[model samples]
Target chain A: MDETIRTILAEHGHLPVEVAKIGDEDDLYQAGMTSHASVNVMLALEDEFDVEFPEVMLRKSTFESVAAIRVALGELTGS
Target chain B: MSDAGLFRDELVAAGLLVLTGTDGIYGRSSVYEDIVAAVDGLAVGAALAEGAVSYRFPPVMPRQVFEQTGYLSSFPDLMGSVSTFTGNNADHRKLMDVAQAGGDWTALLQAAGANLCPAACHPLYPTLAGTLPEGGRRFDVAGWCYRHEPSVDPARMQAFRMHELVYVGDAAGATEHRDRWLQLGVDVLASLGLEVQTVVANDPFFGRVGRILADNQRAETLKFEIVTPISSAEHPTAIGSSNCHLDHFGEPFGIETADGGVAHSCCFGFGLDRITLALLRTHGMDPGDWPAAARDRLWA
Candidate 1:
């Protein structure tokens, strides 16, 4: 569980440090991610996890933290 | 449509200063300023109703950031980069030697790590991501947009103005909002007497998938634009675009609502320069004798 969480964070953590926890819900924009950083993280997550992000999930509220993104991906892929 | 020749004559009669030059820049005259002021007044008036605050963005951006955004991959045809050298006289002479020999001189000098911003959205994303609210939100923005299209037409320039109506809501809501604005936008242009047509468009993302994506976009009707013929009477020019970004931005910014849901986002952008071109074509360049209705809508 820890490794999987770290992997996810490694792929999506572009915001400033300690912004949130692996499984805790936090705001991505509020936590300090810039728009350019957010785009990089999104493209990275898609590449690393081999998942295509749906058009509906592309907003500031979705990439709040690892937990939120994981929840979004799980729902999208039904994993 | 107004007669093109008569419109030119009106432009002359109005004493609108026109400077014909071989250098690419055009339409920076007193009349152009008048047009910009009029458009800005209308935008500010509309914004007051929505409680949107004003913002200004710079015209340049970080090079690495742009590369990460796929700009280099997509718009190599239109993107320009800043370049510089750091060495002393010896290094400068070495660079000149390569240039004199006609070798790979460009590779010798380091890229300046800066890029000319092609659109207003480039800077906006950073600002939005920096100061986004707890839930989803919206913004009304106006910025000078730039593109290096290889054309001498006065209508098509390296720099122009863009007015954007942006909304950050849930996915369904964002899509609906964009559609609503598309219809309203048509009425706004028609009220000024410009003949326009709405068509699907793509921002030309990079690579093979980009081509497929653009094609599928048209097939699926994911994007649409308001266009009219100005630069060319045959192929219409895009005056405004209503874009639905689905989750592309949501996944990046982490913008969510109280229910722990990722908000969907949409934006509608009007190319003020292109719109001016359309208006010039439709209403005639001389504002002095413009249709009484159009004048009242503008000056008043």
Candidate 2:
């Protein structure tokens, strides 16, 4: 899971050091998640898991942190 | 490239010039006949698979249909009606005919029957109501839509062509259905080498209830939009959108699934014109220099 998170962050996260220091519950937008960056995050998530994120989960809150996104993926995969 | 850049480059590549209109109707100097044909072909090929049929809708619809759907009350500013004019002799004859036979010709046209179809989806809804299949159905619709906007910016137009991919099905099915198509939209654009941002967005409908519903539904149902950084970075142009109307249209339209329950509906609409512009912006207008992968994917 840490490796997966690290890969996702590397691929999608624009803020390198901040993403490393922050917890999963922190807001991505507050940490500078532009619309384009968030989309990159979504694409990375889809490419990593090979599962489509439900239309209902494409909100501002879902990309808040590594942990939040992990939680979302867990729910989607029922892990 | 920005809208201005795309506007200029596409014109040159296609042997066009930007001509301003006296009536303030902005138009391309290029002959769009080929462009329209190319877009239609690309859209049809990419969107529809084998065995999918095509359907065309009328340019206008009855006013009652929109009223029932709550669009008239919600978006009255954008609504247009076909108004009738009766002159002196003709008006007198009609008045006498009404007095004698108790029927007025003016009332017929004035009845809730002359509203303009502001968006392509308006006419599709009434036709789809109570006539949908037991499971679900997909529709490929294209039409000329009207809006009462006061913007001269090329991005925001008073009249436009809309190509929509609509899906009607059960609740979870509908959400998943739109999600899948939304992903397809992203993939298609990426293949074109356009850097798009799929963000959470609300519908353009205006009203207190509409705003509330948009916020609540966008949060819970996840209405994602694939937008390009055009016009401004803060407010980018929403080139594509995925909507999951969970039973909102179904209950009103009497659309149901095989399980005898109202089904949720979803749609993924792509503004074809915006996509063309985005492509031109991303990869310059020179077809020769355009990305090989993008051209192959789109031309495929």
Candidate 3:
């Protein structure tokens, strides 16, 4: 799951730095991902996992880091 | 060439814009002035036909009002406060010395009592606080608005003009007013031969927490913008927007409707400069070369 999440981030994050170098706890916004880019990433992640982000989950903190995204997906998929 | 590059070149070639070696600051040529005036006249005429009361406001308002509006809380980064050189003779000498030394001289300036108007309808709400008549109130307001966003995109300038029609009334009436104007905006722009689209939109709120606010706004469909390709087809610019505040302003300002309930408010804002740029982008540089329908619509 971690590898797949990293792959998705690498594919859709639009970050300035390589996604492989970022820790799971690292903030993606601090790695140069903009708010607009974060929206793109969110849409791509939904497509990859086939899960929709509810209104409550639509926030900066939901996509703030790899860990936060993992937790959100875990809850959605009941992992 | 990119769309932005082409538009920039056309603006210079036609003398619509006078560049000042700065990203956002520029002088408007007479032709540009004429086009802006014509657009404003048409828009104001439409508002007047809708029984809108006209009010012209200065570009700057008292800082106290600015703070009371909660603009600073949402968009502190974009607010441009006025400042002045309130220095004595010695401070002036020091300022000159710092300037001659190629050091920062703006430190001598103190914050003035006012901030540049961020939105044309901001000052109107406070003035309309006390009471309302039978139906409600509608205002046709125009003002030069300022934001601190200095960008290279001509469509996104630091200073621009906005013509706004604001409505303050009951929720159903205000929403209906906004809906009507949204369609009117599309029809007017389409008559000018510009391809326009209206979509759910949100303001650029500040910081991480602002993300939630933006999402809630879009979810509620509180705002919509009339978008056209001023910069690029992929990333079109919003030339006009319609917003429903839904008692956000009324509760704070103590605005009461005829029924004594808090009034809901709505506003339709047109970015005059961006619309002109959209015209140039869609229909080449020369006014003579523009579509007959667009030319006739503007001239008529």
What is the Å distance of residue A54 in model 2 from its true position?
Answer: 33
Model 3 CA lDDT for position B239: 96
C-alpha displacement of B269 in model 1, angstroms? 0.9
Q: Rank the candidates by lDDT, best first.
A: 3, 1, 2
Scored against the true structure, residue B192 in model 1 reaches a CA lDDT of 76
DockQ of each: 0.04, 0.02, 0.13
Candidate ranking under DockQ, highest first, comes to 3, 1, 2
> What lDDT score is found at residue B136 in candidate 3?
93
lDDT of 3 by residue, B1-300 (tens): 666766676788788888888766789987777778878988899999989999999999999889888788679999999888988999999999999999988877899999999999998888997779878999999999999888768898888999999999999988998899999999988989889999999999886546656875776688999998887789999999999988778877889999899999999998999998898888877777888888888886
Preferred candidate (TM-score higher): 1 or 3: 3
Q: Tell me, by DockQ, which candidate is best.
A: 3
The reply for model 1, stretches above 4 Å from the true place, is A1-79, B1-24, B93-109, B130-135, B261-263
B190-281: candidate 1 lDDT, tens digit per residue: 77778889888877755433443454455446688998877568777788889887655555555565456666678777778777767777
- In terms of lDDT, the poorest run of 10 residues in model 3 chain B is B207-216
Cand. 3: chain B TM-score:
0.96
Of 1 and 3, the candidate ranking higher by DockQ? 3
Worst lDDT 10-window in candidate 2 chain B: B16-25
